[model samples]
Target: MPELLEVEYFRRLAERCAGRTILHIDVPDAHALADGRSPRSLRQAVVGRRIELARRHGKLLVLETDGPALGLRFGMTGGLVVDGELAIDRLLYSPGTFGTAWVRFGIRFDEGELLFHDPRRFGRVSLDPDESRMGPDAMAVTAAELGRALATRGPAPGPALKARLLDQSAIAGIGNLLGDEILWRASLAPSRPARSLAPAELRRLHRHLVATLADLLERGGSHTGDLMAERHLGGRCPKDGSPLERSTVGGRTTWWCPRHQH
Candidate 1:
């Protein structure tokens, strides 16, 4: 799933389309638009309009245009790609391979093209302007703010640490990947209660969240040396080389180091 860092990465890529008029928008698949609007409607709303700005909240990316804003949620496998041959080839040749099908949608500027590629149809695109459903951006939230937000869920028997982080209202942009990584880095258990965390633990968790996300953002939102990188190949703990544990947490598959991630 696209996490906060991945969403932010796409936002930066979308910025390149800003100030340029959308010469055309091709919705090859109607499923790409979660709102059930016709592709023609999408084209009518965006074509010929200038992309004014691009912003992201949690895992959602919103492209503000002179007309209507386009909301993008990269469900499990979605991303924006620039006009690079390697990217285009990936879409054209490897169509439907690796859960990645052809371009769900695309935007052609005067000199370039932007493509939304998703293999699993889990991603969503909508014309609505309602972003009020999302909480504050993960990267922008401070430690104190995070602490307070997590507190709203109450203590044990409320929501587990993984469950709490997965709630966008509690803290935005954290998916299973990030939740496990954050907990692992904090030496915290995924099943631990949100309110059961000690003050020191909260501090450490916040610190890891900021630092780990910073590194991930630098890595172009791609997981490397993390459990996600090796998930398909039986991921092991990067900390102590122990076999990582995999289970469902917050309705998402989670991976954590049993030896290191207490």
Candidate 2:
């Protein structure tokens, strides 16, 4: 899936569209429009508006125009192609090639064009999407913000640690791959209770979370994590050489080093 890091790349690519007035709007796939949105509605909202900025919140990319802001959600295999250049050369789970039929939506500007491509037809386009439902963006979330997100009520434990991390309502941008990679790097067990972390542990997790996201973003995308290759049967831990363990956490496949992540 296109997570925070991937969407950030898309946002940067979209920045090239800024200051350019939209000359035309194309909606080859009506299914790509979000609920309550259509080709005619999108055209009426942004046909002549100029792109002012490109911003990202979690995995959502927003193109602020002189009129309404256009929001994009790259579901599992979606990507952004600007002026025939792809923000990402390839995605982990997506096909290696791009086809004309995969273009779900597009916009033609005075100088160039942008395409929303998704082979799986799971991506979405909307106008002025509701951003308040998401928590603080993971890329810039502070330690204090993370603490509050992980805080549990009463003495009972909250959801599994990995589950809490994956909850966009609590901390946006973390997907299945990032969640496992961050926990593995922080030496935290994926199955730990959300409230089980002590202050020191929480701080460690915060530090690792920020560092891991930065590292992956620079290296490429979420699939470039250190723990990515070891997320399989019979894979050994890179840190301790112990056998890696795989299980389901938060309804997603999880791999962790039992020897070090405690």
Candidate 3:
């Protein structure tokens, strides 16, 4: 499956690729496309009107059109076409990252539809009014609102690390890949009791989250969120190497150097 980056990443990509408005929206498998809306229908929905914004929240990619918003998910195999040209082939994308963007690609009157090619058709495209009211995303939630949401979810930060990282209401832009990376870096056992984390451990985990994300975003936050991986499944750990181990945590592939993670 092609990695599905958080919407914020896509949104940033979309926003940067400003010009030649989105001529058409294509989504083969999406809840919004429920009941079936033809590609023609999608074309009619957004042929003109400046792309007010393009963003990603969680795994959802949103392109806020002057008229309606376009939302997309890259499922297992999906990509974007600018000006009717498929440029995804030129990029050496990482595992945790997916979708299309040239660091910053734009054009004026490019006058071509943004094509989403997904062989499996597991992804979808849709039009909406308010983007904030979406799923598995925290774009709409304010910092304070997110804090309140976290408080309600419980401050015990260790037990359900997976749930916490995947929770859209908690912190945006984190998915399975990032969650595993963060946990591995912090040395907080994946299945450890959330509340059982020592104060120092909790602090360490929080710092890792900030530091890790900050560093990646500096590189444009591609579909692959882990910088250490650099596209390979196995590599020498930055901290230590004893043949990095790979496992399934919360149903997602996870990797860590046993010598350093503990």
Number of the top candidate by lDDT? Answer: 2
What lDDT is reached at residue 180 by model 3?
Answer: 66
Candidate 1 vs candidate 2: which has greater TM-score? 2
Model 2 ranges with Cα > 4 A deviation: none
List candidate 3 segments past 4 Å from native: 1-13, 16-35, 40-44, 84-110, 129-159, 168-170, 198-200, 217-237, 243-245, 257-262
Error of 3 at 40 (Å): 4.9
Candidate 1 deviant stretches above 4 angstroms: 85-101, 153-156, 228-236, 241-243
The window of 10 residues in a row where model 3 has the poorest summed lDDT is 101-110
lDDT of 1 by residue, 24-137 (tens): 988888998876789898888888888899988888889898888889988877767876422212221134233225579888998798888887768879996577766677
Number of backbone collisions per candidate: 2, 0, 20
Tens digits of lDDT, candidate 3, 1-262: 3333323434444555555465434433344352366656666777666777676666667777677676666655556654454534333332334344321122233454455555445666666624464343433444344333334334544335555555654565566666666776687655544445555666677777666566555554443454256325666565555566666655666566566554
* C-alpha TM-scores of all predictions: 0.84, 0.98, 0.65
> Which lDDT values do the candidates have, in the order given?
0.77, 0.93, 0.53
Lowest summed lDDT over 10 consecutive residues: which window, candidate 1?
85-94
Q: After superposition, how far is residue 73 of candidate 2 from its true place, in Å?
A: 0.3
Per TM-score, the best of the predicted structures is: 2
RMSD of each: 3.6, 1.1, 6.1
